[model samples]
Target: MRPPAPRRTTALLAGLGLLLAGCTTAGDDAGPGESGLLTGPGITETTISLGALTDLTGPYAALSTSIINAQQLAVDEINADGGICGRSLQMVVRDHGYDVQQALGAYTEIAPSVAAMPQLLGSPMLAALLDDLAADQMLTFPQSWDSTLLGRPEIQVPGNTYDVDMINAVDYLLRSSLVAEGDAIGHVFFENEYGENALSGSTFAAEREGLTIVEQRVMPTDQDMSAQVTALREAGVTAVLFSAGPAQTASFVGVAAASGWEVPVIGSTPAYASQLLETAAAPALEGLFVMVSGAPAASSDIPGVRELVESYQSAYPGESIDGGVLSGYGVMEFLAEALRIACDQGDLSRAGIIAAHRTQGLVEGDLGMAMDFSDPNRPPSFDSYLLRPEVGADGGLVEIESASRAPAVDDYTFPTSG
Candidate 1:
């Protein structure tokens, strides 16, 4: 039997509508500021507009909606704190439905108007828009952590790349004695950049540990995991590494449980959704582990996380949230710091934003791992948090391990720009 979905109150939904409508402002015809600070697109004398290319009506809509709400909250808080550099922050949001074409169109429409984008979700969509982003010199913070997005002056990934995340997952399993050397583990992933990138990490870790990986590549549209599970079981895999969406994770784990395959399953951050706890797969998911960049928002002991939870609850009253809320809030805060730096340097142009980001030395905040944003050629951080699902937990997940970089990651070579 499945549990009921979390309660998303009507007031919460209405709040989201109001936030979107309020934040979506058109670019103004105003020019440079009176303070002698050079200004560019998205920045007027009174406001600084940022773009949010997100997904609200697609496979990851639940997560994206939480992210958007958190972002709105961050904007509200920043604006209330006297704004940045004498200008209020305004977010121009556009939902792309996780479609590449739609994302490109949205970027095209907003790129000329906004100074930068704080939230560009979807690996495939970001991959498609890379060239356009570079041409416009738009400073963007992608929600994805694909290695291919690294080393780009215009794009900044907030945490460990997908490959690094998978490597850490494998290390966690091996160290915890969940899997042994010379055993075979199954890897089920999408054929897209996100999945392929994760596969590289698993492949590297398997080779180093003398373990074998049985691969199962699936399309984004693939849902049922009976065939993949059957293949892995036949291959005698001792464990499973999953790098698909939440739906695939539930299906794989549910199917495995029904078939009596009790192997441990480790998945990337995107693979689990809190709402999955409501399904029949809930019991099966209790054994699943997820790798992420930061501690779960709902249960972290960090002071910032506590403040975020209090503020969110106070604002929305009865809305249920997930890790995306913390992620959204953290990424937006990172961008705000960069804007502060740019403002201090007397430049708020798009180029100025990128330059300011490169100067960020060590970033420590309430929502994520400590990262050094000083270099564009390397990942900001290699640490990952291991989490397990718990039904009564605030976000349906609890941190089993805090942020740590695996020893194997030290030897792994990150790919550089071509």
Candidate 2:
């Protein structure tokens, strides 16, 4: 289906409404006047629409729900601030159930109404939509940080990839003396691109530190990892790097605890879900370390993070915020910045947005890291936040900082392929 005519739609909106510019009222001239920059399917004289593709009813729902809430919070704030280029932002959200086919269908339906997709939930979903997004010239902000997603012209990753994250994790462990020179490091990861990327990093780091790397691969469908834990235990691995989902992570930890093996376990960001604290494995997760591309929600050092947490508390008093919410907030904040830059460049269209992205040298994100989206292939940040799960006052995983390994891991190039 073809999108509506940009000029006709802009004219219709302008003819139907006129208020104060930037005054929350629409026609008044309190801010920048209408610069006639509305020239896209989802852009109008006073509004710009963004789409959010999420997993609201599948394995990742717990994380995606918080992400959606935080994204809406960002949209609300953008609208309240009189919008960008005198245009209020609107989010068109859809649940994909973490299915590729469903995500493809949902994308087709919402593509015409959105200038860009600021949030696409999973690595698999993004993979399915890559061709369509490229053909349409739509800018995509994918949630996954896979190394293979790099070099795509239309896709933007907000943080370090799993590969770099693992490198940082290994570097931290070695430097902190959690593992010594001759000790073996075990890696348990999904038998897919995500795990492959993570293993690449660990392998590289292991080679550098003269440590042996032992790997255990599992299918995504497999839930129990007692066998793998047994293998690692027998291998005498001093530290374990996990690149699996929350359930798999819990399985590894729980199985290890049951077997009375107490080696240090480190995981990628997705490995630690807030839901884990409620599971039967909650006790086993204590002191588990995970690496995050962004800062924890509890970190009040970043002004944007502090404001987001405070707002979340007031807006959803009954609900609790977590790391997922912070990740979502960071992504949206990056999108908002890109939109503003596009508006400044006088090209809110898809092509214009991509062009503006290249010119954007450095974007300071609320994720506690600065991003550089000028190159599509390169990750925005190589820095990672090392977090240890502790029982917070709320009885959930409170991510406490362990180390910052950016200085050591910064120069390491993420492998091109998984």
Candidate 3:
């Protein structure tokens, strides 16, 4: 039998997993990398700084600011602990305003200070910089769940959907009465290039299970979708997969729920933010099934899950970490791990960071999985699980464990190629 993970190794892996999965707990209140005498228990160096660009002031404000704050808290914790190789942790933040031009400007200005640039948490913006980020050797912690870029641009993606979570949810639905064995799964996705890949992944997975796409409704990313939802209901779709952001998802799912449609709402990871369930309301979001790439459905049960949760709570008192915060924390934690490995390898080089990301295993961290970006064929989690939304006591969402789903990711052996 495999030996139990060593304690130190487990702690290390826990740290790595939290950073990668953005599991910034309320209790992780370490200040900055400590100084020789100006040290906190975890504090280490004085002033080491990395950069992050976020949608803090824009349309996605629902989760962006909280995410940045969580990332900052993680950095402060590492710095307090005498950060990687004695360098203090500092996070230089840039607000993207959820706009592409602003993101480009922020990206251009902060390109040189840090070892690598973590991408903003938006699809349109990330897509705008795929080639530029790769060209600059700027590695990123996965944010957008779009996986189409995996084989096309060679950009880094750690928690993407096709290879991460949604496929299995679609597979499970296929085996259920939701869809007839030979029937195709219908989809109502945003009609943008970014949302296309999500729909494609569902199609690929559905086909793998002998299901087809019988009716697909493509709508604009930000349009009012009463018509689209109506159309899907009229199509007589048994089940549907939504590939848009929170707003459109709420619109479609809410309408479907109100119209007495019994279709199980399937969603991309982006639409799985815990806030969405509440904002979308019951009748609309009840029994909504969202597949995710990180953390178990009920994270509070995982070993350090509660710790991270409380850490976030303490750090940002009165703040709540809905589903999106988890993603934010996961990505930040992973980036820290890569940075730690980069320092361990002597120099803070991107190549060294990438190497560390590949060689490391669970080490007993939150995501409870290993991440390997050493190959190009796969840029995201080679596997993922499903998260069902169950109404909690306060009439809020509780990601339920209706099923444990993950795809048979057999392509890890595929070479990392563009």
Best by TM-score: 1
What C-alpha lDDT, on a 0 to 100 scale, does residue 216 get in candidate 1?
98
Locate the minimum summed-lDDT window of 10 residues in model 1. Answer: 1-10
lDDT of each: 0.80, 0.73, 0.57
Q: What is the lDDT of residue 145 in candidate 1?
A: 78
Backbone clash tally (model 3): 40
lDDT of each residue in 1-418, candidate 2, tens digit only:
0111111111122311122111221111122336644356677777888999999999989888888887888788777777777889899999999999999899989988788887898888887888788878788888788888888767887678898888888877877799989889999998877888889888888887799999899877889988999899899899899998888999989888877887788888877776677777877788454545455545445565666677777766867667777777777776776677667655677766655555555666544656667667688677677666655523144445533554546566756532
Question: Candidate 2 overall Cα lDDT vs. reference?
Answer: 0.73
lDDT of 1 by residue, 1-418 (tens): 0111111111112232222222212232333466667677888878999999999999989988888888889889888788889999999999999999999899888888899998999988988888888877788888887887877978998788889998998998899998999999999999988899999999999999999999999987999989999999999998899999889999999999898888788888888888999899999999655545444546777666777877877777777768888888878888888788678767677777777667676767656567778777788889888888888887888888888889999999877563
> For each candidate, what TM-score against the reference?
0.91, 0.87, 0.79
Counting clashing residue pairs in each candidate, in order, gives: 0, 8, 40
What is the Cα-based lDDT of residue 11 in candidate 1?
Answer: 17
Model 1, position 255, has a per-residue lDDT of 92
lDDT of 3 by residue, 108-133 (tens): 88766555545466777887877776
Sort by lDDT, best first: 1, 2, 3
- Pairs that clash in candidate 1: none
The prediction achieving the highest lDDT against the true structure is 1
Distance from true position, residue 176, model 1, in Å?
Answer: 0.7
